[model samples]
Target: MSDSTAIFDTLKAAIAAEEPVALATVVEGPGTGAKLLLHIDQTAGSLGNPDLDRVVSRDIAGELAAGRTGVRHYGPNGEAREEAVSVFIESFAPPPQMIIFGAVDFTAALVRVAKVLGYRVTVCDARPVFATTQRFPGADVVAVKWPNDLLDEIGHSLGQRDAVCVLTHDNKFDVPAVTGALATGVGYIGVMGSRKTHDNRTVRLREAGVTDEQLAKLMSPIGLDIGARTPEETAVSICAEIIALRTGRDAPTLTAGVGPIHR
Candidate 1:
């Protein structure tokens, strides 16, 4: 197989196995199709020079941290000046997590939507009867415990790529859920409720020591203003809001505007 094809195969396998990997392709200049395959400890393929591979691999790891994919110019020896090569670094971060803190009907819909969005979803609830693997077959996990307890156990695993959705809508449950989620470094914390419920929960969250800056991390009144009436429609709204928040896009329905569907 060609070098580029071989490197791509390796990247595909690593992604399929959920292993962190990156592919650096020489998109411009000499050796246009030259490629490098890198993992945390090992390296495969090459960009011609040993020093260039080492330097580019290290830089690619940093790109992977932010889950970025883009092209960068470099000298033949990987120097900053003189664009002898242009490498496209594609990061394959570990799958992002979706921790849904409710086992209600909305939870099922959210789990389905999250899965469709490529999240490794977990369904959590304090009640064992409500939080069952059978009830949420689409979820990767179903935890029967208090939200704070779960966070205390796995909060460290959460990071910018992870999301925590508070759908319990009960002040007692949601307060702890929001508090626990905020304590983590999760990127998104969406709380499901009407405007009135969100207003009341704000007071409870403040009492629980969630600061204004921290509360700002929350997307209360949860989904976008899509006027959704069904659980499935609400799920679409919530997932769309998550995408918009991540991409910094103003949430607008496709039918309401004109643009390329994917850009």
Candidate 2:
């Protein structure tokens, strides 16, 4: 098949299967009308030159991960900022996943926020009573399983587009949840707790074989420091933090700030 036909077919299949894919089309300057179909595993077409295709693919992957669509400029041979080519990258990404390792009241609020933000959410807790579908109606799934077991089963499916939130706060549940999530490639791992709780958990986590480098990925006291006092407000704060993380934005987080979280 021709490149155009192959790209069209691949794009349709990917979208139908709810797979992440991006299309980069040169709409201006050199190689106008050139196309490149980018998927997580492979590329279908090219943006004229290999360098152009490679550069655009990297940018496309970032846009796809963030579920964004925009036009980008580059030189004829992929040099930065020369504007010799204008490639419009259109991302068709499946909904990002947010697996919350707790079924507390805060988990329900977080499920609502994550659903509103287009995440496919899952609420998991070892307590079968707490992990009911009715309690987290907005969540896509609910599992009454241990955090480590659940993570072991589904962790391989997680990518940089996904997130894992540990809100159990209890040492028995929270520490194991954090370590399990750290093993996944999920872009965000937020743990809910206070300053003292975090300090105490850090000691336990270190003993659990969590290294400083892996511990750095934990967004303890998890959320933007917006004085969120209630569950609903904290839900918003957490969702905002996720967005800021995905877009590489600088925001004041509870993790970085000191003092009381309540105003």
Candidate 3:
């Protein structure tokens, strides 16, 4: 088989395992069909020139982060602003993760909503009976562990595509969950509660060493201002808020409103 075929086989295996990878192919330029495969820690193949491969590798990282695919223009020897080459960068990113820190009725509802949005949802709680797979059908994982302990194991892997939702209204559960989620690089951190509960959480989070900048990252009283009442409705509101935040839209979040969250 050719070098390109070998790279393509590796790419296929990586994608099959849901591992992150990117393939940059010279589609319109010198040495068309030249390929470069990028993984998190290393690279394989080459796009003809070492300089061109290096430039496209950097661009591949950004494209992989956003899970984007498209052609990028560059001059010969990888110079910018000149279209001497067109490399199509294809990113194969794993599904975004959504870890729900409570196994309540709302958690089940949220799991369904998150899965519908292509998130790999996990339901976690300290209570074994509540955090069973039977209770949270369709969840990718059901962990009966404290929020902090669970985060300790997997927090480092979380990136901009991941989300953490602290739906446990209880102080004992919410405090550690919010704190742990904040420590990660996850894109969205939402805590579910009423205005009063959010105020109480804010104080506790502050006492727990959560800084002002980190506090701003938490979407307390989570979800959009869609007048959600039932658990199902609330789940929809929360998922909607997640999408809006990811897209950088100006939707009114529950945290931004005063008084009651429900109509």
**Per-candidate RMSD, Å:** 5.8, 4.6, 2.6
For residues 152-250, what per-residue lDDT tens digits would candidate 3 score against the true structure? 999998988899999999999999998888889999999988898888888988899999999999898999999888889999999999889989999
Off by over 4 Å in 1: 1-13, 252-263
Model 2 TM-score is 0.74
Best by lDDT: 3
Which residue ranges in model 2 land beyond 4 Å of their true spot?
1-13, 23-87
Lowest summed-lDDT stretch of 10 residues in model 1? 254-263
Q: How accurate locally, in lDDT, is each candidate? A: 0.85, 0.90, 0.91
Q: Candidate 3 at residue 129, lDDT?
A: 78
Rank candidates, lDDT, best first: 3, 2, 1
Q: Model 2, residue 119: what's the lDDT?
A: 88
Q: Over the full model, what C-alpha lDDT does candidate 1 score relative to the true structure?
A: 0.85
Candidate 3 residues lying further than 4 Å off, grouped into runs, are 40-42, 45-68, 76-80, 207-213
Query: How large an RMSD does model 1 have?
Result: 5.8
Q: Taking the tens digit of each residue's C-alpha lDDT, what string does model 2 give over 1-263?
A: 38789999989999877788999999998778889988776988888899988888888888987779999999988989788789999999887899999889899999999998888898999999899998888888999999999999999988887999999999999988998998888899999988889999999999999999998888998999988888999999999998899899999999888987665
After TM-score superposition, what is the CA distance of residue 236 in candidate 1 from its true location, in Å? 1.1
